[model samples]
Target: MEYKWIDNFIDGLIDVYGTKDIYELYDSLEISIRKLPKCNILLQGNEAFYNRNFLNKEVVFIRDDLNMEYEKFILCHELGHAIIHTNIITSAFSRNLLNLNKLEKQANYFALKLMDLNMDEIAFEGFTIEQIANSFNLPVKCLKLLLDSKNQNI
Candidate 1:
């Protein structure tokens, strides 16, 4: 089933924050929930405990120990789940390792939406990397990388 939360988030950002761009919305989300502790453990290929979960809880547990973009994305990915996918996730599903479920997919989709963007001149006139950097307040490189990759997906 389609997650309306994602669309709701976009619409709410547009309505309340007056934000029409994806990165700007994500940056707004980051600003709204900015104090999430950064902590990361790379169990990526290990697959032992690839991630953690808090059902219906909007919290971010970023593994700051690792500095890789993937870890950052993982943190944001979990945040995406918390924001957009937790409502549909069932109690039984939350109990075990069903890492590749639909909710997880939706979370990944949210992450992808947040990360992938195109800053066109008509859309973002006089929008420079420096301005985007200032707006999101992320490093130019990080923001640029996120904006550049429009073909990636969950």
Candidate 2:
């Protein structure tokens, strides 16, 4: 599925929060990811963390117990929400009521871009899907999404 919103938001992010690097981009946007103890009550049993508008700013609360790989992915995903969904923060409607699948997929795309992930960095000729995912510290499912998006672009 094509999501025009992703392109528009990415353009806006590049224009508004452009920086010398990804770390600077995050800083320029004032996006922070804080690690907290794992608690099911916090985000209603979500796997990792959650983002919210706090004091007119965007904040991500990630589980401290998550492994480094999960940490990287979750941080990127929440950052995506902060950048791509900033405008909707003031809306009364719940994001869960929206096309959540599309939103999640868009966030995945946003994350990969922010990470500067290059498929060329990984060898695929003889590697299994699981091997590729493990080598790159990525979830296989998300890797598939990234590959699919890349294929579509090509």
Per-model C-alpha lDDT, please? 0.49, 0.68
Task: Kindly list the per-residue Cα lDDT of model 2 for residues 41-124, writing each as its tens digit.
Answer: 655556554456666666676777877766677777777777676555424377556777877787887777666566664357
Model 1 error, position 1 (Å): 8.4
Q: Which candidate number would show the highest TM-score if scored against the true structure? A: 2
The C-alpha stretches of model 2 lying farther than 4 A from their native spots are: 3-22, 89-96
TM-score of each predicted structure versus truth? 0.41, 0.76
Candidate 1, residue 109: lDDT: 54
The TM-score of candidate 2 is 0.76
Off by over 4 Å in 1: 1-8, 18-58, 88-100, 117-154
Residue 95 local lDDT, model 2 = 57
RMSD of each: 9.1, 3.3
Candidate 1 residues 1-154, lDDT tens each?
Answer: 4545675664564688675453354466552222223332433332112222335323343433544445445545555665555344535565575555655556655554555444565766778878865554345655544554443421
